[model samples]
Target: MRNQFVGKLVLVAAGIAVLLVLTPFAIVPAGHRGVLTTFGKPSPEVFDEGLHFRWPIAQSMHLVGVAIEKGEGEGDAASKDLQTVKTKVVINYHVRPDAVVAVYRDLGNQPGERIIVPAVHEAVKAVTARYTAEELISKRAIVRNDIVDALRERMARHGLVIDEFSIVSFNFSKTFDEAIEAKTTAEQLKMKAERDLQRIEVEAQQKIARAKAEAESLSLQRQQVTPELLRLRETENQAKAIEKWDGKLPATMAGGAVPFISLPAKQ
Candidate 1:
């Protein structure tokens, strides 16, 4: 009985030892790289997603995400025209899978706060200083490109790759906004005045055309009158009076002579 009990104790000890030995193995989740460290020193080799083993108590594994992540940052700056400008930007980035060890050794787990945020702030201020406040609103695409280019150059050395970038907002001073509005309104009023002037000119030209047409008609009528036309008109009038006289002169006359419409001499 004692021998059997001793063998069972050995088996239990062996099982516990096996469990202890297995504790050094770790499973790196998907989309992440395992960073190994020995004696608080980061390892040069990065472990890909899967099971990896390290010497127990002498090493540790840290997972660094290689997946794309979003970061947002805002900064206040002065434009080239000395206008106050507030800018916000969003960035998409990821750690180079192969550079996880170096990144971990240098930047640690908070690369977004340590590297990306400051880069965004710096890039925004630098680019904004080159453009006027109005240009920042008008040339938005160009400004965003400038900021992205600057951030790419700054972040690449730190093992962060800029995948995408965008300008979220650009705010200006109240006085500047009011000035732009006033300018737009004034331009609109000027355009309306030009259109009204053109209409008035067209209407005046139309009136002049009508007056000239009436004068031409009157001149034409006057030119048609002549001595022959006047004689013909008088003879037609005398013939009409004779037709209505019933072939007899009036019984009474203003003078002692027969009262009759004198016929015009034949022309």
Candidate 2:
């Protein structure tokens, strides 16, 4: 009976040894940082991705993702023109690996909620207020840059780093949308009318040019006609008339539309 009791004690010791050996080792996956805590208090040690070792039962490691993470936030603000502007922003960011413990202590695990969202909201509002509604739409890229710059500066204070910030959507009031539509239609019609007017003007100019060319050609022909040309025309007409005339002369020279032929005084 004593031999059996000794065997059971040895088995219990072996099980505890296995447990202790397994407890100290941890697997830190890729794109993650492990924050170590000893005696329920966070320690300064941060472990990179790989198998890690710590005090068996007295220490623990919490994994924090160091990879770029995506988040979306939205808010509404009044433009300089007093128009209500609604903005939605998408961001890609990650906590600074070296500052993981600081982040966990200060901003907690969800830094995006505590830090990023509020910063985006405030920055967007501050920038949006500087521009009128029309300007906001036109200068969207510039506003996005400003918001990103503001967010980067703001988030870095809490151990967060921004990779990219994009303004995904901007929403305005119905009045603004309707106004834009009306303005677009009017501008399109105005452009089409101007183009038509230009086409008509071009055609009129062409017609005037053709008329000028024809008038100039006729003037050149008139300038070349001299007295010599008139006399030559008269001689040509006489030749044609002689070619058709019979070999006889008209007697008495046609009195009262009828010619009285005299027989040459009977000789």
What C-alpha lDDT do the candidate models reach, one value each?
0.90, 0.88
What is residue 195's positional error in candidate 2, in angstroms? 1.8
Tens-digit lDDT track of model 2 for 49-116: 99988887788788888999999978899999999988988999998999899887777788978887
Q: Please, what is the TM-score per model?
A: 0.69, 0.78
Model 1 over residues 1-267: C-alpha lDDT tens digits? 999999999999999987775587978999899998888899889899999888887888899999999988777999999999988888999999988987888887778988998889988999999999889988999999998888887798988899999999998889999998998899999999999999999999999999999999999989999999999999999999988887764766877766666699999
- Model 2: how far is 193 from its true place, Å? 2.1
Worst 10 residues of 2 by lDDT: 252-261
Which 10 residues in a row give candidate 1 its minimum summed lDDT?
Answer: 248-257
Each model's Cα RMSD: 8.8, 7.3
Backbone steric clashes in candidate 1, count:
0
